[model samples]
Target chain A: MINEEINEIQNIEIRLFLEALFQRYDYDFRNYSQAHIKRRILHRMNLNNFKNISEMQHRILYDPSFVQQILLDLSINVTEMYRDPSFYAAVRKEVIPILKTYPFIKTWHAGCSTGEEVYSMAILMREEGLLNRSQIYATDFNHKVLKIAKEGIYPIDQIKDYTTNYQKSGGKESFSSYYDANYNSVIIDSSLKKNIVFADHNLVTDSVFAEVNLIICRNVLIYFNRELQDKVIKLFLDSLAPGGILCLGSKENLQYSTHFEMFSVIDAHEKIYRKEYRH
Target chain B: MIEQKSFPIYKPLAIVIGTSAGGVEALTKIFIGLRAGFSIPILVVQHISPSSDSYLPKHLNRLTTVSVNEAIDKTSIEEFNAYLAPPNYHMLVEEDRTISLTVDEKVSYARPSIDVLFETASRAYGRNLLGVIMTGANADGASGSKLLREMGGFLVVQDPKSAHISTMPEAALQLAGADYVTNLEGIIEFLNQLK
Candidate 1:
């Protein structure tokens, strides 16, 4: 069909644009899942009033500001406080006991958009009397989102959902005790932010920088192609200490990863896995 | 004659449906009557709570002869199956005839937004796409339905008067001006006519 042909042409243009972006900016999105990237590009096209991918490709090559805008659109920043409460419940019941054994705990919340989950983790640790011994590294590739994450503030309207998730996740204290409300926004308690370090780190381009006891990278790998996902999994494996725990989004699994055997499934429903030590 | 003129006769490569509020009941009526050997892929975005388990596909699968499943990210789409967008994610169609899922911020206060699916599928299928907006409480599908029509895709809406929650269909009719406005049974008859 003529429509199919047109789509194919658009696909080629999109690939070329991605390549040009990498060659010029060193932001390697070449291995991201194509369908997701394409959708983002199409969404960008509609917003910028471009007729086709070819036109967008031209602008990407010629305009720096346009490329930056596209980069923001391409990044998936959807997240919430205590997302998947059951996962947190599993963490409280299963993973935290192992974490308590460590003299000093190191946790990496990779792709920590706006740091909600990071704060959630800190609150959980605080309640368990482990906050003093834990250092949480919250990293994301998008500096724009990273800046917001460092602020420890969120819209007041979303607090209701966060509160429900907290109770579901077995919170010992009232959710209101954690934040100070300022009309439209809630500033997360300053103590909750004390142990968290927010930084810009791209899973695609960056190498493992720290050996951690637990790594929580949820819903981020779904955006990556299989090859890139394998690479990132390898990176996580290298970064994790022996017997370290890895928690993924409910929908994500290590089924296709080459390193699947290296990790023992801790809680299947929660998608929590523990790195196995070689005899 | 006027109705015939409005409903353009053309074979569509795929059908994209968006609904909310009373989507489960409305979708059941449409799927229950679908005859076997239907070939077009049906991608749907039915607004649901983020924490809710995906029971829609399973429920619909029992009622229809055609296969129905929750769409996975980055999978190639196949005809003869209805792919429902999973909770807390937006489902999109890509140029390679594959499904893409995103956790982007909620549009129109919803993830798995009807507008997101319709907008992307319209681009991928172009004039070969058939966009159907059904019973719901919000205006979420209106802009996306408009986009699909702009891309030359056929647009259809459930008659607002007959919809369980009329606002969604009414919005689609007001904003996109569908080629056909019919009740549930009338929409089923129209679908059966597609080759």
Candidate 2:
């Protein structure tokens, strides 16, 4: 059918466009699943009202602004405060106890879109009386989301919902105590982010930059193919200190990865694993 | 010049879905109406605790005509059956066209993540896909559904009001801006009409 041919042509166009993007921009989506990459590119194309992928590629190649917009579309950066409240509850109950033994802590929240999870961890630390002794590194490939993460501002209306999640996550204090509500946004207390470093880092291209007592790279790796997943997990294994905790998104695990034996599940339901102390 | 085909036959081979918090009730309503002789494949990723042994397939299978089972790695994705992504792994369609499981980290705070399965299937099947975003708490499936829509695949979302948890559908509507928005009953009727 005519429609089927057009669909196939569109697929080819997206493939060519991504190839061009890597060749010129060096973003290296070459290893990502072809299906995911194509879908992302096509979404951008439609949003921009380009007739086809070729038009979107032409604009991306020539216009930096367009490329940035495409980057936002490509990153899949949707997140919310205490998005999975129970998961955080599990962290507070299971992981915090072990974290208390460490003299000082280094934590990493990889693919921390807009820093919600990072801030959530900061809140958890504050409650556990660990805030003063911890340093958190929050990283994402999308610079735009990273910028938002740094700002630490969120829609004021969402506070009600986030408060509910906060309570469900077993917050011991008033949720409103954490932020000052502005006209349309809530400015998170500056102190919560004091030890948090929001940075631009790509799991696809970047290497581990810190040795940490705990690494919480929740919900970021699913975008990649198996080979890429293996690569990222390896980075986490290398970065985690001996006996450090590695928390993953519930669906994520080290079981099938090359680093499977490097860590053992502490709370399998929570998807919390501990790096083996290889002495 | 080619003759235009009338009422382009939409023989839906598979149905893939992503949902968050309130997905269970919504899925039950939709599946209950799809009787045993239904010959389409259904794959679903509902956000659940990694430790929670989702007896979802078993529960839903009891209500629907179609066979339901939790997806296993390397299993062939077959028609007239439903596959639910297991609790802690991302489910993907391999190049060999079989179900491939990944221990990859969660995307969008979910394992058996909706985004992972939807995005991968969009790549594997292109327009030969039907992606649906149902009721849940977070925005997990929005971008993936958007991707499927762009790839010329059919897109559907549960009407936010009808969803037990509206966040997922609301977010999908805002981001992907779906092609069809309907209640669970309506979605069932739509699925029936797909053939």
Candidate 3:
């Protein structure tokens, strides 16, 4: 068959595969960016050594574990503490001051992934003296990763980079003081976890569950198609209290979002936007 | 932006460029040397530290007449512009010909893998995609260039001897020999002549 024919066939199979995922399980990834979903599908197919998406679909019918693996794979867990140092720095300089004015803070960290970012934010809040007055909902669709998040254990080797990021993000104290190295991994200070509630939240299907002063969704929006992105942004708009902050991934923006006018820029370079106080 | 159809006769709709170690200089040269108002959307993947700031576009935009900016997710492939992949993200071409990015595991030890972009661009643009491999220190783009060639897309390799670092161009030649192997000036001339 011709090359275009192959791509066409693979897409059809992928569509069926996504349908299978949504129907069999309640996970709806049908609206994800086709390119992102295609890459994930191809990656999984190569790993399983399946000749085609059809074979993958066939296995989906028989193996429950296979389904679980695929779902986990679909949820992007690629993140690190202080992934973008400047973003955290902006949070410290811009958002923290506003957060201080409020008596209490509520934060919804959508797609918390392995919890690196959630813990990173928790550390920031602790330093800013807002941890005790803050309630953070760190959530993801993947329960498996949520368990890892709750533990706050990361590789010791990775800690070095996180420390550098921490320092660059205007860290006030010794980074080593935040965690205890235990063998190959470092366990985060338990104090960071006290204000964070790790839970299950699927951005794809879930609605706004709370009113919050800050919403840090970050890179999670890029995985979605434009339509879904707008839908999710609406959910965020509804969830945020007026003048609340909504930070997104570096590449993601409200340029094409339907709800673009509803937010004002706090830090354009850092992708921090505040919901219009009156709106 | 001049239309690709205005090219009397042409084989490419998009140009994809990838490089590493010596990429900043090489890409700057290509962008500056190309005729003003070059209409093809040049998609570039240059290796840098994961936390590297958005310096490449700012640097290039000041030097080149072609508007250069970081590729945004779901952005369309418009004419007379260039898009560079963001640091620590894998930029792919969707079937709709828009850009899609991911933080998937690195390919060939590079987040914005040349192979990833080339392979996807070849699929999206088919024989109309022109894959360019220039000065670099890694073999990230070789396999992707090979796949691009397999999909009937064209390949352009910067002559290894002329490259500041020869490892990348030489690797591309060994794995996916280009339709045109030339120096920086020659590549620029070829692009300008596309009009």
- The best candidate in terms of lDDT: 3
Q: Is the docking of candidate 1 incorrect, acceptable, medium or high quality?
A: acceptable
For candidate 3, give the lDDT. 0.88
**Candidate 1 ranges with C-alpha deviation above 4 Å:** A1-13, A42-68, A182-184, A256-261, B1-13, B36-39, B149-152, B192-195
DockQ scores of the candidates: 0.34, 0.13, 0.65
Model 2 bad stretches (over 4 Å): B1-41, B44-55, B61-81, B85-195
lDDT of 2 by residue, A3-98 (tens): 456766876787788787777786767666554566567656677688888887887788877767767666666677886688899989889999
TM-score of each: 0.86, 0.72, 0.95
Residues B25-49, candidate 3, lDDT per residue (tens digit)? 9988888888877788889999988
Q: Write the per-residue lDDT of candidate 2 for residues B1-195, one digit (tens) a residue.
A: 111223226765577988877788878887887755888788899888865676888999899878888875556688778899887777887544667665544778877778878877776677778888888888898888877777667788888998888898888888878767778888888788776
Per-model C-alpha lDDT, please? 0.88, 0.79, 0.88
| lDDT against true structure, model 2 | 0.79
lDDT of 3 by residue, A7-71 (tens): 88998999999998888878899999887787778888999899999999989877777877997
Scored against the true structure, residue A192 in model 2 reaches a CA lDDT of 94
- Candidate 2 docks at the CAPRI level of incorrect
RMSD, candidate 3, Å: 3.4
